[model samples]
Target: MTDSSVDYGAVFKALVAPLLVMTPDFVILAASDSYLKVMGRGQADLLGQDFFAVFPPNPNDPDAIEDYLRASLERVVATGERDFMAVQRYDLEATGRQGVFEDRYWSAINTPVLGPDGEVELIIHRVDEVTDLVQQLGRSGERGVTGARAELETMRTDVYVRARQLLDVNERLKQTTSALQEALDRQRRFVFDASHDLRNPITGLLTELEVALSEPDSDLHPVLRKSLRDAERLNDIVADLLELARLDTATPTTTEPVDLAHLVMDELERRTLTATVLTRLDKQVVVCASRIRLARLLGNLLANAERHTTTTIEIIVTTDPPNAVLEVIDDGPGIAPADRERVFERLFRLDDARRQDPGGSGLGLPIAREIAQAYGGHLYAADHSTGARFVLRLPFAA
Candidate 1:
């Protein structure tokens, strides 16, 4: 089935801001109408030209405007993040006069548009011209310079510094706005997935109960058992969801030094699995973390390995200097190279994962990773020769 999508290029071109879109190599592609109007340039003047060649630094100012702008654009492409520049003084060539420049001040931001391969394919340069305000300050100084020239010059310098400070505050506000938008998008997706997951077992339980109620003389035992299983599944999902929500708050928790090797031994003794388990633990390896949460993290990893491994599971614990490292390796079908990272996303499951363990709550890995990260540690799926391998690293207790 085909899907409908927006023409983002058209939307970008019609944006009501002074925007210049360029290639990664700094070649100008399209200029917004606002940009053309502000710079007094035609489409033919900017399209297909080099960005720097068209808008060179003011030859009059000693400050390196071109260098600053280039560096900002390079950073956007390199880090795939937006770059905001402080208020800058860049002069433009006069419309009809040769070798004459017009003073301009601008607060600029550059953002990257990444392509499918996660490479920066295009950059959108946005500028808000502040020349009028700067020029007004300059004129204010000139008006009072008749008797106190030096004092007024100092006042103008102070006003310029204040203007830059205000610009920085505005940039921070913009960053906050972007962050809130992303958070809202993530929340929306999370709600949708949660609702879908909850609806399934609910529908099944209601259907089975309704059928048994309608048939008074039928064997209700089977219906009750099925309903009970669905209810249990639903409960487990809700519990996992609650655990994830708690982890999301990221509130600081009191911690104590916990022996890692001994804790693993205790947790292993509690579980019964079909696969053979092997352990290679380093004694006296300890870490500072909540013991309950650490057990939950370890439990999730082991449960996941139990669900996927074919015959054998290897548990290793060792100290790598400041870190206490743990590895959980299994002999099941290994994770695909592309899916190692996506496995930790909440509610995410591969086709093989769903078939291997239908009753599994997909939140286990995400919750495990969150728990590790809460303690300033890391958890990730590592490449394995046979099946799946998970590695966890936590700071050794000081």
Candidate 2:
């Protein structure tokens, strides 16, 4: 229809969403019927009134937004441009089932309507309710923090998946370009896993025999009992090897807030450690971590300290923003500066007469570090006066 024949009020009212048209002087010209219904305003009261007059800025708005709409509209009229407002809480009077007045979130855009002489004649107001996304974000704070963040991750994950698919094409074209060291690493991982898998049954056998020995008058062989103890130790080495192998193919770890102090205290209780242990754990410190792996990681540190030190052991848990740190300190000879890197090597053994009594298979540090790295953490050795100090650092869970 021609502009002269068209009923702008009828057309705007027929729209489903809340929208309005206002003259350059900010006088409300027309509003959608739905807009009035949603806003709990009568057309008679709104028409010919300032747009802000009908729905004033909420007194409780944190942004002090009373002047925001007015200022934005002025800018749009002057520049003949479109103004978009960020998602914000804007309290509005209830319409139908809604209460008298409730705080609601909305995204709004103000567009200037120009006249035939290229002067601003009117403003078109379009608003969208975003209360649902805001509520969802508040409830599931761990998910992409906000609605926009959650949506962003979904988009990123899709792009990442597609990019990963491109690797197949690259593989065919760059078959010879594949890194040889990666292939060697894979081969090494396979050997370690294979050996551990084969050794697990021997550990199981020793455990059963130990159980049999527990029963008095069972006439279990003395030689077999000794062998069982040795087998048990070997089983430990194999278990660590298996853990290292698992690290070679670590999966994305799903984490929840874990009480660092509680986990460590519980582990200490289970072991009933003989050494004089001192703990300086902050009860409030927590980390995003896999519960099972967190326990295992702490347990390994305790075991290593206890095995090497005859004196006191100190356990300290602290937080460094973005990371939660657990330190295990013992009163024994500390690691040599040169051997730092070698200690984390799978199946590596320390060369020290004082540290050799445990006769461990050298996989403890490797496995411990493996678990740490799997969860985007780091395990490192540091020199301590009395003995060795090992530090574990993991990211703070959101």
Candidate 3:
């Protein structure tokens, strides 16, 4: 008998395990029948949708599981390896409900499928819904054990499984925290060494240049002036590095209710800009943050806009309910979608930035983001129709 062609797609759909196939970029390609049944979702409703869009993070939960899910999927794509996620609390949109969601607990694993070129093509996401088991266990201590022998045995088995999972989760968290702390320490040491090494040489050069330029009849006036500027730029680089090193290891000493709109207005007023500055300020937007750090954050943003802006720089401050929002927009070459996230990487500069400001230290945006994150906020390059937009979101003051 001739070998028959296999129906792999049908077999995948009919698999006992709940699974979803998504592209590396997280567009849902397909879902298993088990997955559809478990999620209470129609196949048509999920296909061709972005994963995050379909299951947006639960805004009320500060420790959002979507962040972990996204990070795990990204790691799978990057490493071409499977990632087993710790049991997480991710609520699901309720069936037949327009604006309601149900609590969910899930154990998931993401595995990457590689193409012929050995690159990740699609990610296979497998999830096991353990919400019922989790809820039962949470109430076990309060309710006491008043069940049949078989029921109690099953509960005991589940408790063992959950204990093992928690142990694994704690180990992973410990390892990750340790690795991150080590990397941070290394970075801080490097920054300190570089700053210490450069400061004295730069100071000496600047002083010698000033002494030379102070001579009235010097024939090297033009050259000395240029040299002085170069030395000053070097000094600025050392200063920036020191600042970044400090921020990397420091926390805000004092935080108070700061009117965000007034802060932006004050920052704008203090700056001298080549581009026309405009604002749409909401005066009542307030956040609890260090005034000094907020000033530095705003200064970096405006300085960044000034560097790339051709004619107009706009600053907008408004309240977004739970958070106060600030947007700095420039009418210049917008950031490429790929570079938007990379722009916040320390010392990572785009080609346009290099040409626009050759002397830039490239720490401005990174420093700004560090400040934002320290205050339980976020700084990110947002999509804009005309030019580049940088948005800062900080929780509102109590």
Q: Which candidate is the best by lDDT?
A: 1
TM-score of each: 0.75, 0.48, 0.53
Worst window of 10 by summed lDDT in candidate 2: 167-176
lDDT of 2 by residue, 250-346 (tens): 7666777888899888888888887999999977777777888788888888877887776899999999988888999988666788997888875
lDDT of 1 by residue, 182-275 (tens): 8998889888988888888899999999998898899998998999999998998898888888888876778999898998999999888788
| Strongest candidate by TM-score | 1
Model 3 per-residue lDDT tens digits across residues 1-398 = 64469778898999999999999999999999999999998899899999988887777767567766887888788779888876777888787885577888888989999999999999999999998887766556555555654566578567646855684576578569768988998787656755654665566677767767697577776656677776777877767776777886784468999998889877878877889999999988999889988998899999899888889999999888798999999999999999999899766789999898866767889889998998999999999998899999999999
Per-prediction backbone clash count: 0, 2, 0
Pull out the clashing pairs in model 2. 332-386, 332-387
Model 1 CA deviation exceeding 4 Å by range: 1-26, 29-47, 53-87, 91-147
Q: Between 1 and 3, whose lDDT is larger?
A: 1
